[model samples]
Structure formats: C-alpha cells, structure tokens
Target: MDSKIVLITGGSSGIGKAIGIYLTKKGFTVYGTTRNLKKYPDFTEFQLLEMDVREPQSVNRAIDVLLEKENRLDVLVNNAGVGITGPLEETPNKEILNAFDINFIGPLNVIKSVLPQMRRQGSGLIINITSIAGYMGLPYRGIYSATKGALELITESLRMEIKDFGITCTCLAPGDFATNIAAGRYHAPVNNDSPYKESYGKTLNTIDQDVDKGGDPEEVAKKVLQIINTKNPKVHYKVGALLQKFSIVLKKVLPDTWYEQLLLNHSKK
Candidate 1:
C-alpha cells in the first residue's frame, strides 16, 4: 500500500480532492487531474495534472505523463462529474448532452485511456464515484440520475469483462455531501412562464439545501480507502445518510407507483 500509485479525476476539489489527500497521507502516490491547473495554484494536497475528460487526446496525454513518471497506475478513481437538473421537457438539448458528456462519456474516456496500463500491470482497481440519486429518478434530476445510473451499469459489465485480465471495476454511489457541486452544476433556470415553474422551483431549492446540509466529503474519502484495501470489492457500494441509502432499497421492494409517491412526498418537503 505504501507504494501504490493512484489517479483520481476531478481531484482539484470536492470528493476527489478529499480522497487524494487522504490517500497521499496514507503513503500512496496520488495524482489528481483538473481541467484548469491555475484555479488550484494553492492546492498542495497532491499533484494536479491538466486534463479535459471530454477530450480523449487530453485524457491520454495526462495519463501518459503519470505513467512515464510512476511507471504504474494501481488505481483509477472516476470521480470527475457535473450535475444537471431540470424538467426533461424544459431542459435544453445541449445541456442534456453536456451533462452526459462530462458525467458519463468523460469517465469512459478516462477509463479507456487508463485500461491498457492497468492491463499491463496485471493488477488494478477502477472505482467510479457515482451518486445515490442514480438508483432512482427524482423529479428535476432525471438527467443527472441517468448519467450516474448509466455509469453504474457500465461498471457492472466492465468488471466481468476485465476480470480475466486481473483488473477490477466497481461503483461507489454517494448520497448528498457538502461540496461545490451545487455551485457548479448546470441548473435550468426557473421560468416564470413555464408550466413547471412552481414545482421545479421548489424542487431546485430542496436539492441545493440537501447538498448544503450534507455530510463531510471526508466520509467519501474514507470509503475509497476501504475499497482500495479490500481484496475483493463488491460490484456496488453506497455511502450516505441512512434515509438516502434506504431509498435504493425502497425502490427495489416498493411498488413502482408507491415508490414514486414516496419520492414525490419527500421532494415536496
């Protein structure tokens, strides 16, 4: 563990930065990627490389730089993502695509760039930081949920496909955590003229409040460390408030309509 090499995307801030800092203190050589290095000129927790997950060439270049220096990448954490919320009908097509590009395709690009090196190492772990919301569709967060939910399914398939190559892939879905996500997410403006004005506006406030009152990001960092130490990790793991994690279970056992109503009631609060 002292010599493990780890790469975490979006490591400049939020959950990614927390994880990188924790791992570095635990004796791991951690490198995190950021879209803009200048924004974090004061970031000293770990080294930050420049990379745009939406661009394959940029992703490759950043990983190449890491590989050339460390010669091995023992872990890859797909923690880079952006949140989007709106009524599907009201959301712009371009915003929807941008959400998927950054939250879904972006991670895929990073994974594709990192896989060859992991394959050569004959041992590696890929942990995707998804969201508990991914397990269900909330009223205004359908697009964000879809992006994370898609990544969860992809991780399931990826694990089996790469098992023979001595590599492992898994998803860790976190519930609301106090972070900069709410500040950075693309929120479709509340249109006073739109039909969803009342409901969408209320739901948007609830979403932001949840994030504001969320748990510390270090909780997620600790979970990542646990996953790294485990010899055989599960296909999916979740860390969040009890009610939030229970929501996934509710979705599984409750009738579809009943679960829908439960979410509706919760959101209205």
Candidate 2:
C-alpha cells in the first residue's frame, strides 16, 4: 500500500488525538476510535470512527470499518483507557470492574480482533500504552497500576507469541502528561468515617500536582512516530521526564524497603 494505515484507540483527545494527527501528517492513513461521534467533529487530517473498546463486537466493527477501506493495517495502538483513585477498601467493586474493563479488557478485545487481519498481512505493529505506575504500585491508584502492569505483561508474552508472524507488540510506559484525564478520573468518596480519607486526599493531590506539571502530549506523539519509523522496535518504550523515567530504573536498583519508602515519600502531599 502507498499509505500505511494506522488504528489508534481513544483518539477523541489527549495523546491518542495527537498521535493520530502526527501519523496522518507523516503520510499514513490514520483511523481514530472514539466512543462518542458527536463530541469530535470532522478532522481534516484523520477519520474518527466510533468504537467502545470495552465491547468485543464494537471493537471488531471499528476495525472492520478501517479494513474495508484501508485494506491493511500497519499499526494498532491500544491507547484507550481510564484512570481511578481511591483506597481499595473505599472504592466500590463496580468502579474497579469498570476500570479493568476499559483499561485492561478493552485493549484485549482490540488486540484479539485486529490480530487476524495483521496476521494475513504478514506484518504489523501493536503498541500498548502502559504507565510508570505499572512498574510500581501507586497507592490510591493501585488498580490502575495493576491494569497497566497486566497489559505490560500481556504485551510481552504476545510479542513472543507473534514475532514469528512478523508482527510486533510493544508497551509504551509514560509518566504524567498534560491531558484531560485528570478531571475525569474515578475518585471514591472519602468521608470523615473513612480511615484513608486524609491519606487518600493527600496522595491524590500529589498525583494531580505531578499531572499539572507533566510533559507535553506532543512529545508522546513524537515518540510514537519514532517507534513507527524504527525497523525493529523494542518491546518496551518509556517516554516522560527524566525524574519519572528514572524511577523505573531506581526501582530495579534499590532495595524493596527503599523503593517502597521512596514511593511513599513522593506520593505524600
């Protein structure tokens, strides 16, 4: 194909939107997935298609729409996910399930749906958006970290499984970034009776502060472009400030107690 086709989930805004625009400018036909078509108007640069990653049928339908026109998929980016903050005890089971549905299972659905086409094409790229939190637990956001960690593990095994078919699976672990996800994050209600009320509020405040001062989304888009251009991309790509990126390294080099203390100190507002 003259134009390589790219499908990126959660493309309504944030990093996903930026990535779609960047790839489109690079001469690739980009298809972006959004749950709500009304929210995102027509983009001169790329096409926005309706997709709910949480539903297998919806994911398949969205990919089918692209396959019908593009004929082949060169890249599939699983960037659609949700965030949550709450003490495990205080957080409802429903909220936790919803988070996993969107963050973990949602990507799984897309990956499984797109594999058949990619296999037939004989080559493709699957990029899963993970987080530094995946490397270590983020207290109030423990479930979110678990979801990312799970995705990271899956991508690793998936790469090993699909390498023979000329398909590549990579995980992109990013730190805080300037995005609209903060305002929409799921936060459990903390009342006076809750034991973790004060701590949860403090930890969440610290996390929010980092997000407020996070890196630009354009940087992330640039990194995605770099990955796409590489002939052989690594299984894991980390993008963010040195301070945050280094934390993953530090986690490996430091003792367990030291690492825990570091996280505790950093998360305390």
Candidate 3:
C-alpha cells in the first residue's frame, strides 16, 4: 500500500499541531501550513510551509508545492480559523470579515485547490474543524457562530456532492478545546469616552473565564485521528465532556425559544 500523505492548514499550533503530530506518528506523511513560520519551527515528521488560507494565491502556491513533491494527496484538513467576540453592535466590520474569511472562505479555497487531485486519486478525506457553536448559538459569539454555521452547511453539501467522486468529507465539531483560540479573540476598538466602556470590561472578563474552562486540545486531536481511521466517518462528531453532549442533544430536542433563553441566562452568569 502507498503511504498516506496528509496536508493540514493552521497546523502551527493548537488542535492542528496536535493532529499533525498524531498523524505523523501513525506513519502518515504530514505537511503543515501556517502564516507564522517563524513562530513554529519544522518538526521531525512534519514539513512546514508558509501559507495563508485567507489569500487564494498563497493557498494555490502551497498546493502546487505539495503536488510537485508528491504526485498524490490523500487528506486535507481545513483547520485554519479565527474567533471574534463582542456585542454585535460593538464588533467592527473588519473583525467580522476576518472571521468569515478565515473560518468559512478559507476552507472553500483549500477545498477548491485540492479537490481535483483527490478526484483523480478516487479516494481521500477532508476534515473540517468546526466548533459546537456551529450547531448551538452562543452569546457574544454571533459572528463566530455564523461562520461555523456556514462551514457546517458547506460540509453537508460537499459530503453528498463528493461521495460520487470517492472522496469523504467530515465535519469535526468540537465543543471547547483548551487552545489558544481564546487568547486570540478579536477585541473591538474602544474609546475611553464611549458609553459601553463598563460593559466591555465585563465582556472581556466573561470571555477569559469561559476560555479557562475549555477542554483539552490533545483530546480533540485524538478524535480527529479516530475519524480518519473510522470506516464510516460521521457527518458531525462532537467532542468534549457531558456538558457538550448535553448541549448537542438539547439543541435538537428543545424549542428555539427555550434554547435562546438558556444561552442568555448562562451568559448573564
């Protein structure tokens, strides 16, 4: 059998890095792409490339480089993303655009670039790292949830479209992995004279507390590996503790009004 070749975006750190390491250890050739090469050095089993998912040219160039080195590509993991947190009214236009670009458009760019190769090979996998926010709306994460929701829809459509081509698409929806995502949350510009100054501080504090309780990134990575090896990968795989499992069930069982009220109540506390 030919060795598996996997390409991962945003693999410099967090869940992406953990996935790269795990796959490499499992004997797959791992190619990792990141915008910050200086921050992430090359690893033993993984080759690092400079690529920004937000830029089509960068994504295409990186794909060309990989194709030139290896004639066949087996897997593409679209893990590059960003988060924006603030009241919708306070969030800037640029921040919202960036979140959508990185979270939703970025994956589409990668899929467009790599789909031809996978189609030719007649077998491959595309893993999308989505959040539970994709399914359940959360307070102060309107923009982020919107982006993930878009991804979820895309993943569903692609799964049916690509099945005929012998390619599989899996959307891995993790609840809250303990990752740097929280630290990297985008903050809206504040004016000292602004009326929302006091509320902004409280919002930031709430974000900090939520992030501190996020699940372990390594555990999420393990789930990614399992999905890759599973005979029948699920359209959506939820990872985390009981709370996360409950949330997913509730989203399906409860009415929208009740769900919204529950989220609003949690946010206030």
Tell me the whole-model lDDT of each prediction, alpha carbons only.
0.94, 0.90, 0.85
Q: What's the TM-score of each model vs. the native?
A: 0.98, 0.97, 0.92
lDDT of 1 by residue, 1-269 (tens): 34899999999989999999999999999999999998888888899999999999999999999999999999999999999999999899999999999999999999999899889989899999999989998999999999999999999999999999999999999999999998789999999899999888889989989999999999999999999999999999999899999999989999999999998887778
RMSD of each: 0.9, 1.1, 1.9
lDDT value, candidate 1, whole model: 0.94
Q: Which wins on TM-score, candidate 2 or candidate 3?
A: 2
Q: Pick the candidate with the highest TM-score.
A: 1
TM-score of 2: 0.97
**Runs off by more than 4 Å, candidate 1:** none
Ranking by lDDT: 1, 2, 3
15-103: candidate 3 lDDT, tens digit per residue: 88888888888888899998977876545548988899999999999999999999889889899889887768878888899999999
Worst ten in a row by lDDT for model 1: 1-10
Candidate topping lDDT? 1
Where does candidate 2 clash, by residue pair?
none
For model 2, the superposed segments whose C-alpha errors exceed 4 Å read 42-45
TM-score of 3: 0.92
Clashing pairs in 1: none
Clash total of candidate 3 = 1
Over 61-110, each residue of candidate 2 has an lDDT whose tens digit, in order, gives 88888888878999999999898989999889999999999999999999
